[model samples]
Target: MSSENKIEPGDVVKLSGAPNLHMTVDHISGNDVTCIWFDGSLHTISHKFSLSALVLVKKKGH
Candidate 1:
């Protein structure tokens, strides 16, 4: 993915191939990422995912 497409905290993203898997970026580390869902759920995913594995929804305006 391009630098502009990199995920940041508060950005809303959906797992590209997963059904109904949406999350809000909560934190990002070197290769590990964390997110919170609309239902107050938290998850961690690998940053090495291909671009097709994630879709950026809403960006954090701040």
Candidate 2:
């Protein structure tokens, strides 16, 4: 994972950079981020990013 990549909560990540396909990261890890789908499914993505690439959208509301 490059230091340039910053992960945060509420970030709408582009899953494969495809139009409309995305996920929101609820938490961030050292080299991976934890994401949650509208269906409540959880996933962990690496900072490197790929077809499952993700980006920081916004911070989670307390």
Candidate 3:
């Protein structure tokens, strides 16, 4: 990852292999990161993913 492409806590990210599903990075521990997203009913869903699996969501007009 490049300097500007770094993923930090609170940044919205998605799985690089699984597109479209947006998630937020809660925290990171070594090679794993905790992610959270809301489901259809607005329930909070969370999981830990490999640090490499996360791709930062880019803002429009960047």
TM-scores for all candidates: the values are: 0.60, 0.46, 0.85
CA deviation > 4 Å runs, candidate 2 = 1-5, 39-52, 55-62
What candidate 1 gets wrong by more than 4 Å, as runs, is: 40-53
Q: Tens-digit lDDT track for model 3 on 1-62? A: 88667887878889998797999888889989999999999999999999987888952234
Worst 10 residues of 3 by lDDT: 53-62
Please identify which of the two predictions, 1 or 2, would achieve the higher TM-score against the true structure. 1
TM-score of model 2 (CA atoms): 0.46
lDDT of each: 0.67, 0.53, 0.85
Query: Which digits, one per residue and each the tens of the lDDT, describe model 2 over residues 18-57?
Result: 5565667666556566665553354544333432355444
> What TM-score should be assigned to candidate 3?
0.85
The most accurate candidate by lDDT is 3
> lDDT (0-100) at residue 18 of candidate 1?
69
Off by over 4 Å in 3: 59-62
Please, what are the lDDT tens digits per residue for candidate 1 over residues 1-62? 67678787788888877657777777776655666664435345434343346688777884
Instruction: Give candidate 2's whole-model lDDT.
Output: 0.53
By summed lDDT, the worst window of 10 consecutive residues in model 1 runs over: 42-51
